[model samples]
Target: MMTFSPQLEQKFAKMLTAYPEGKKRSAVVPMLIYAQDEVGSITPELIDEVARRCEVTPLQVDEVVGYYSMLHRKPMGKFHVQVCTNISCLLVGGMELYEHACKKLGISHKQVTADGQISLEEVECMGACSWAPAVEINYDFHHHVTPEKLDQLIDGLRKAQ
Candidate 1:
């Protein structure tokens, strides 16, 4: 069985406490997210551990994982790049930006680089319409990105690794 670090255990406890009585199940999603943030991907052990803590069935935790887009069953790259191509972004050259990133990274959507340093995904929306043509590397959002800027961003991330 995989053990969660003390810090993660404390976070889980804090999250569980934030909910009212009999609502522990509500913490499932966030708990899984936090767990993934630490361990990468939703492992069987994590599903079981979360299920035990939330007092829900392992199957229930699995269901929750499958429902959320942010949750992943497999490990992603160290830097996961998500480009928004929704209408708001599309109107501002988001699709072109995505193409530029794909070409630059030499990887298609949902594909990781051969070195496992980066992964790319074309998302529908990132809720950054006003900043249109937004890109997210991991949790940080970059607004109004151009092809040259994307190159710089990717190059920077590569160098950081």
Candidate 2:
């Protein structure tokens, strides 16, 4: 009942090659990322399966998932909007941007919209210091975002979806 396939096993094997010998533990994160990509969402069962495939404990796998906000443990909405609220972004009104997105969607940070189309989150950073107060929607980077732009983006995404 591991819910794994040969294709998944092959992917795990290939990703494991990126790490050094007898250091499969170092490959845990990548493997979990692969698992997450394959399933879209990480379940307790999926974590356990990744742990078995990577020869690590379930706790170890779960720990990695919990440590990273980029890693999704539960199912997210159609769009996952992660706003950077760290120091660099904060100085550029990242906090206000997050608040605006929440108010616009009527869902607080980390909460999915009622229609399951949007999920808002406050992340540490998005590595676009030049474009501080940025947001990543469905992994697409939107830099130097303003409240008006946020509304436009949400509207466009809703229409597209």
- For candidate 1, the lDDT comes to 0.91
Top-TM-score candidate index: 1
Write candidate 1's Cα lDDT for 42-126 as tens digits: 9999999989899999999998888888888988889999999999999999999999989999999888999988999999787
* Cα lDDT for residue 97, candidate 1: 96
Error of 2 at 19 (Å): 2.1
Model 2 lDDT tens row, 1-161: 45546898787778778778777788777777766766768889888877776788999888888887668877778888888889988998999998898899999877898888788888876698888879899769998899999999999989988
Lowest summed lDDT over 10 consecutive residues: which window, candidate 1? 1-10
Candidate 1 off by > 4 Å: none
Backbone clashes, candidate 1: 0
- Stretches of candidate 2 off by over 4 Å are 1-11
Q: Distance (Å) between predicted and true CA of 60, model 2?
A: 2.6
Once model 2 is optimally superposed onto the true structure by TM-score, how far is the C-alpha of residue 160 displaced, in angstroms?
2.3
